[model samples]
Target: MTTPAPEFNKKLGFINAFTAATLMGFVGFFARHIDAQGDFIAFSRMMCGAILFFGILAYKGRIKELLAYKLSIPMILSGFFMGNCLSAYITATQHTSIANAVFFIYIGPIISTLLAVIFLKEKMKPATWFALVAVFIGMMMISGLMSVGPNGLSFGMEFSQETFFGDMMGLYSGVGYGLFLFLGRYRTEVPGDVRAFWNFVFALAGITILFIFTKPTISQMTSTDWMWWIGIGIVCGFGALGTCTIATRHLKAAEFACVSYWECVVAALFVGLLFYGEPLSSGQMIGGALIIIGGMSEVVISMLGKSLKKTDKQADAMGAL
Candidate 1:
C-alpha cells in the first residue's frame, strides 16, 4: 500500500486537533447536567473513557497491542499530569468564578510554548509571539475582563482566600496540561490509540484514588445524568482525546497549543446559544474573531515558511547541477 502524503497527514492532523477542541467545548455543558461532585464526575469520566477506549481497541483487534505496549516513565508521568490538570480545573471552577478558572487554565498555551522553546529547542518567530499576545488579549475580552460597566472597564484585583486557592489550582492545572502536551509532542513513538488508552488508564487510577479519599456524596443520578456521562466519556473521551493524540504526531507543541484556543471560542458560542439563549456581546464577537485570526495566521505563516525553505533547497540543488 502506498503511504499517505506527508502534507495530507499534516492537514488531517490539523483537522483532528480542531475537531477535538470543538468537542471538548461541550464538556462544561455536560458537566452542568450531571449534578455530581467535581471529583466524582472526573472519576466517572476517566473510568468510562478508559473502558470505551479499550473497547474500541478490542473491536479493532488492537487490544493486545495496547495492553502489551511497554509503559515508560514518561508515559506514566504524562498520564498523571493529565489527570491532575482535569481534576484541578474542575475543582477550580467550583471554587472560583468560571471566568477566572477558564482564563487561568488557558495559560496552558503560553506554558506549552515556553516548554517547547526550552526543551525541544524550537525557535519562536516574532510573528508567532505577536500572535500569542493577540490571542491572550482576545481571550481576556471573551472572559469579560474588558467589559464596559459603571466603573468603565475596571481592572480590579481582589481575591478571597477561596478564590486565591482556586486560582492557584488553575495555574497548577495549566502547568500540568502544558507538561502533558510537551511530553506527547516530544515522544511520538507510541501509537496515538495506545497512548490515549494508557492516558485514560492512569487518569482513571488517579481520580479513583481521589474519589476514595474525598468520598463526595454519591447521589442517585437520573437517566439524563447517565446520558451526559456517557457522552463525556465515550464521545469526548475516546473521540476528542484520541484525535488530539494523533494530532500531536503531526504538529509542533506550540502550533497545537495555538490551534487548541478554538475550544474557548466554541465554548463561548455553545454556552451563549444553549444555556443563555441570548446574543453575544460585541466584545465577545471581536474577541473570538481575534483569536481565530491570530491562531490561523500563525499556523499559515509557519506552513508557508516551511514551504519556502523546501523550495529554496530544491532551487539550490538545481543551481549546483
Candidate 2:
C-alpha cells in the first residue's frame, strides 16, 4: 500500500485526534451517576468495550490475526498496568478531590517524555522541553498552589488527603499510560487494531479478576449503572479507535504524544459541564488553555521543522541541477 503524502497525513492525524477528544467528552456525563463501586464500573466498561471492539474485528475478518494470538509481553504488561491504573484512579477519587485527581492525571505526557528520554533514549526538542515546563506550571495551578497566597500560606494548599490519594493514583495512571504509549510505539510487529484489541482484552480480563477477588455483584446495580457502563464503552472504546486511526495513519511518535494530551482538556470540560453544572474555574480554564497550547506546540514545531528540512533539500537539489 502506498503511503499518504506528508501534508495529508498530518491533516488526517489532527482530525483523528480531534475526533477522539470529542468522543471522550461524554465520559464525564456517564461518570456522574456511577455509584460507590467505581472499580466495578471500570471493570464492566472495559469488558463491554473489549467485547464491542473484538466483535467488530471479528466481523471484519480480523479475527484470524487475533486467533493466532502472538501476544507481545510488553503489550500485555501495558494493558495490565493500564487496568491497575484505572482501578487506582477510581479508588483515589473516593478519597480525593476530582480537581487533584485530574490535574495529576494530565501529567502523562511529562511522565511519558521522561520515560522516552530514559528507556527509549529519545531526545526531546526544545519546544517539547518548554511544553513540559508549561504543563508543570499548569498542574501546580490546577492543584491549587496559587490558593496559598496573601495571608500567610495554607499548609494544605487546596489538596485534601483524598486529593493527595487521588493525585497519587493519577500519577500512577499517567505512568501506566506512558508505558502503554511507549510499548505501542516499539511493538511494531503487532498491527495497531490487533494491539488495541488485545490491550482492551487484557485490561478487561485483569479488571474482571480483580472484581472477582473483591466479590463484586451486579445484582446491587441500578439501571442507571448499566447505562453508564454502556456509555463508558461507547466513549472510551470509540475514542480509542479515533486515537488509533490518527496516530497510525499520520502521526510520528512525538506528534502522537502531543495529540493525546488533548484528552485531559476534553475530560476537564466534560466533567465541569456535566457534573458541576458550572463553568470551569478560572484556574482550570487557564491551566487547560496552557496545556492545550503546550501540547499542540510540539506538533506545530515538528511540522515546521519537517517543512524547513524539505525546503532546504529542494533548494540543494535545484543548486545541484
Candidate 3:
C-alpha cells in the first residue's frame, strides 16, 4: 500500500483535530445539565467512553489486536496523563475561580509547543510562532483577562492561598494534557481507536479510585443525570477523544494544540445560545476569530511547505529520468 502524501495526512489531521475540538465544546453544556460532582462526571464519562469504544473494537474485530499489542511505557504514561488531565481540571474548577481554572488549563498549548520543539525537534517557522502568539492573546481575551478595571486595565491578576492550590491543580492539568500530546507524537504504531480505548480505561481506573474516597457515587445520580452523563461520555468521550488521538498521528503536537483552541470558540457559542440565551460579546467574537485565523494559518503554512517539498521531489524524479 502506498503511503499517503504528507500534505494529505496533515489535512486529515486538521479535520480530525477541529472536529474533536468542536465536539468537546459541548462537554460544559452536558456537565451543566448533569447534577453530580466533578469526579463523578469524570468517572462516568471515562466509563461510558471506555465501554462504547470497546464495543466498537469488538464489532470491528480489533479487540484481539488491541489485547495482543504490547503496551509501551509511553503508551501507559499517555493514558495516565489523559486521565489526570480530566480529573485535575475538574478538581481545579471546584477549588478556583473559573477564569483562573481556564487560564491555567489552556496553557497546555504553549507547553505542548515548547515540548515539541525541545524534545521532538519540530522546527517552527516564524509564521507558526506568530500564530501561537496570536492564539495566546485571543485566549486571554476569551478568558476575560483583557477586561479593563478601575485600576486601569487590570488583568484580573490576583493570587491568594485560597485559590492557589486549585490554581496549581489547573496548571498540573495543563502539564498532564501537554505530556499526553507529546507522548502521542511518538506512538505511531498504536491505532487511534486502541489508544483512545486504553486512555479511557486508565482514566476510569484513576477516577474510580478517587471516587472511592469522594462522595456522589454513581448510585447517587438521578435518572436525568445518568442521561446527561451517557450523552457526554458517548459524544465527547468517544467522538472527541477518539478523533483527537487519531489527529496526533498526522499533526505535530503544536499544530494539534493550535486546533484545540477551537473548543473555546465552540463552547462560547453553545453556552451563549443554550444557557445564557444571549449573543457573545464583541470581545469574545474577536477572540474566537483570532483563534480560528491563527489555527488556519498554521495549517495552511504547513500544507504549503509539504506541497513545495512534494513538487521538488517530483521535479527531481523527472530530471533523473
TM-score for each predicted model, relative to the true structure: 0.88, 0.80, 0.92
Candidate 3 whole-model C-alpha lDDT, 0 to 1: 0.81
lDDT (tens digit, per residue) of candidate 2 on 1-321: 543333335656666766765665555667777664667767655676667767878899888888665676887876676566667667666667665555555565556566667886777777777876765655555445433345743323355553565667767776766665565555554555666677777877777777766676677668887787777766765455435533534555455656665665666676655667756667666667776787678667867877888899999999999
Tens digit of per-residue lDDT, candidate 3, span 156-175: 64668999889898999989
* Lowest lDDT 10-residue stretch of candidate 2: 153-162
Identify the leading candidate in terms of TM-score.
3
lDDT of 2 at 221: 69
**Residue pairs with backbone atoms closer than 3 Å in model 1 (clashes):** none
Error of 2 at 266 (Å): 2.6
Better of 2 and 3 by TM-score: 3
In candidate 3, stretches whose alpha carbon ends up further than 4 angstroms from where it belongs are 1-8, 148-154
| lDDT agreement with native, every candidate | 0.77, 0.64, 0.81
At residue 266, candidate 3 shows an lDDT of 81
Better of 1 and 3 by TM-score: 3
What does candidate 3 score on TM?
A: 0.92
Candidate 3: C-alpha RMSD to true structure equals 2.9
Q: How high is the lDDT of residue 60 in model 1?
A: 94
